[model samples]
Target: MRASLLLLAAVVTLWGAHWPIMKVGLAHVGPLWFNALRFLTGGLSLFLVVALLGRLRVPPRRDWPLLLSVGLGQMMLFGVLVMYALRHVPAGRSAVLAYTTTLWVTPLSVLILGETVSRRKVVGTVLGLAGIAVLFNPLTLDWSDRAVVVGNLILLVAALVWALCILHIRAYRGLSSTLELAPWQMLLAAVPVTGAALWIEGPHPGDGTLTFFLVAAYAGPLATGFCFWAVNQLTARLPAATFSNAMLAVPMSGILFSAAALGDLPSGPVLLGMAIILAGMATVVAAERR
Candidate 1:
């Protein structure tokens, strides 16, 4: 249990830091190109590790659908949406909104997957939206400022789409090791992401600075590759509710990391939103435990 806790913490920290890390990388490369490069690098890194461990293999035919969903829905769509959103949204706020996918999952599961929705989850869902509303601050917000509104809405929709992907993953039952499928999923997602990059973003600039390379390395290898592997390791040891709840910390940590790394300080409303979001997430976790 202690080991699981530590592993969970590490995963949360890695994911949290990724928001700002990605922001840094994007400063040096186009969003679409950066995503393609990072995922391609991550995929190859995972392939190397899995191959060294003698666990790498092609996924079976039936598994392709699940893999495709993960690649398309979770990887390509989610990454592209959030990356574009991050251009206009603050790193901390973007993290907060994106993490709302967890909040969306329960209600979505109940509605689409026919799973039961507890009263607590309903309350949690309400609190989560309230947090978003508060952060949105409609009373003072200029409706004409399309950038901010569009950025926030994109994040919210991305979170919902991500929830769908999570449901797809949860519904899959398979004999192939997750590690084995992981590289393929990355590669599958890479094809479209790369294509979009070529068509929309053209090629990355041939000359990248040291800072760009450093940020790319962190985003690709540590954030994407190792973070995925670490979470998979901890998942089997931790309770589902505990794991989900632990993820609530990721965005909060993202706020702090962004403040330090990117000098992104949250405004009062943002802070309040973060608190409320955490409270909502707590309620959801408690309900799941019950």
Candidate 2:
């Protein structure tokens, strides 16, 4: 009810803000360790919650591969790749690009998934991209800067992998609830993340500083764990259009949280871009309402 919505909102806000907080956190922790902590802590926390709620259950063996794909794609590919990419890019810029994938997902859904593109959805996609351009276009390679090249490339790949993961999940309509799959998938996904942290991150982990612990815990438990659980719970009752449409607010919240967290200022063009994006989202919401 009210509490669940607040939890989801808090989770999304933290996740959006995590883009910047991670920039600071990653400085102290290596890439693998950062991701390892993210998945491990959140996975374990959700494991307990799901178990207590009696929602943890494994699908049949035939379905194992697909479930594992979601885990690997999300936890290993998207999570790890973003961590590596963030090493090279600014937090705010990376946040903008990470979300800009709405543009890619729309067309891909049409071609690959055979989902028809309503004009409102198309408008939403275009405006979302325009917003991204305003927010992040200048952050790209310039006349003098080449340092973030690797990071930017990795982020692009991460976004595509995420779309793939999301599309893969969309193909699954009989999961009962996404929460029912979390403990299993998180457990399955943890094996690789642990090994990667061990092999790639070297011997040390981050010092248990107050800031590090808080940010890391929030990203894993509140953001990923509780958020996904909430998604499963809410979507079971709400219309897909209603549920999906709520995502339109995420980028705006991300930017607002960015300004609050980092004291980063959005330029006039960026603000205008955000407005256009909201207008597009409104169009989609309007169409869906009918």
Candidate 3:
């Protein structure tokens, strides 16, 4: 159990950094291509690892639908849309908004999975959102323009899709192991991401430099491939609250990634907002623990 928790914790940190890492890659590659390469390469890498481990088990025919659904919902829906949102907003703020999925996941579990929501979860949700709102306020959102409002709204939808995916994963019964499920889902999601990249970015994504290739490699093999493996295994063992709370690391991870790679430091509102968000997530997590 401790090992499982650590695996998920590692995933939380790696995935948290993903937003900033992908943002860096997007400087050269189209958002579509960036997602496409990450998943395609990531999925391939997972397949290779599972094959080497001899732990790969194909999902049963009955489970294929569920896995595919999860693939689209979690990977394609969350990945593609978040990329779109990132193009319009700052990566740090985008990281905060994307996690609204945690809030959405709480209600979803109740409605879809028939899970009971404790008062703690409810309060945690509110506090988390409050912190998110504080972070968003610095943007001084202008709804009059289509881009700003539309951008924020798009990110909200991305969060919803991801939240729904989390619920669906819990409901789906066919998964045999995280290793098998992680790769297959990536392969499934790769379909849409590649299709979108082709449609928007055209056949050629331009010749990437060494830096571009390096970032893409990290995103694919390390971040997407290994991270998914870790998440599947850990989430399978833990409660959603435990898994989601681990994600409190994401905002901090993104901030650090930005500071290190982008040569940027977080502003006062961002740091303040991140602190509040962590506190709120802690409240919810503590509530769940008790």
Candidate 4:
């Protein structure tokens, strides 16, 4: 249990830190191309590791529905929308908005998966959403600006897409382990993303900077590949609402990491929102421990 908690911590930290790194990468590459490269690199790395372990195999036909749902909806569509939105959104704000998946996940899990959520978890989710609302202060955004409005809306849609995928994962009873199927899922996402990048953006070899490569290494192998596996592993063990609420920590940490890496300092409301979010996550953790 201790080890699982540690792994979860590591997953959250790596995922949080990746937000700022992605901001850096977007400076040197187009959004779609960067997303395509990320999925390709992540897929290749996972494939190599699984092959070395002699665990790689073609996904059986039974898993195709899940593969397409997660690959296309969660990974491909979510990645594309977030990347495009990130171009206009601040990394910290973007992180906060993107993680609203928890809000959508709780109700969906109960309705679709027939999972019963504890009242504590429900309250925690509400608190976390309240924090998100605080951080999302409409007063701060220039409502007249189309790019800002559209970008924020896109993030919300991405969150909803991700929430649906999480429910599918919880409901899945499949022949392959999550880790075993991860490479194929990534590959499935990569193919169309790469094609879209080529068709729409028309590739240019990135600025050839060391920073770009470093971003690729972190976002691909560690964030996308390893973190995805870690998340699924935990997801299988925890209740859906509990798991989703616990993930509220991701935005809080993302904000801190963004401040550190990108110097995107948080204002008073952001700090308050982070505190509220932390309290909400703590509430969920306490409920789980009981």
TM-score for each of the candidates: 0.86, 0.87, 0.90, 0.97
Question: Pick by TM-score: which candidate is best?
Answer: 4
Against the true structure, whose lDDT is highest?
4
Candidate 4 residue 205 C-alpha distance from true site, Å: 3.4
Pairwise TM-score winner, candidates 1 and 4? 4
Error of 1 at 34 (Å): 0.7
Which of the two, 2 or 3, has more lDDT?
Answer: 3
* Candidate 3, 33-109: lDDT as tens digits: 88889899999988888889998877788777668766888777878888888887777778877777777766667
| Candidate 3 vs. true structure, TM-score | 0.90
Residue 224 of model 1, lDDT score: 72
The alpha-carbon deviation from the true structure for residue 140 of candidate 1, after best TM-score superposition, in angstroms, is: 5.7
Clashing residue pairs in candidate 1 are: none
The alpha-carbon root-mean-square deviation between model 4 and the true structure, to one decimal in Å, is 1.2
Over 73-120, each residue of candidate 2 has an lDDT whose tens digit, in order, gives 766778788878777776766766666556556666667767776777
List the candidate 2 regions with Cα displacement exceeding 4 Å. Answer: 1-11, 138-140, 229-248
lDDT of 4 by residue, 1-290 (tens): 67768888998899999999989999888888888888888889999999999999999999998889878988899999999999988998898889899878988888888888788888888888888889888789887989989999999999999998888888988899888888899999999988888998786736779988888888888898888778877877788887887787888888899999888899999988888887888888888898
Which runs of model 3 end up more than 4 angstroms from their true locations? none
- Candidate 1 C-alpha lDDT tens digits along 84-197: 998988787788778776666656666676766567767776776677666656575456889978988898898887677666666667667668877888898788889988
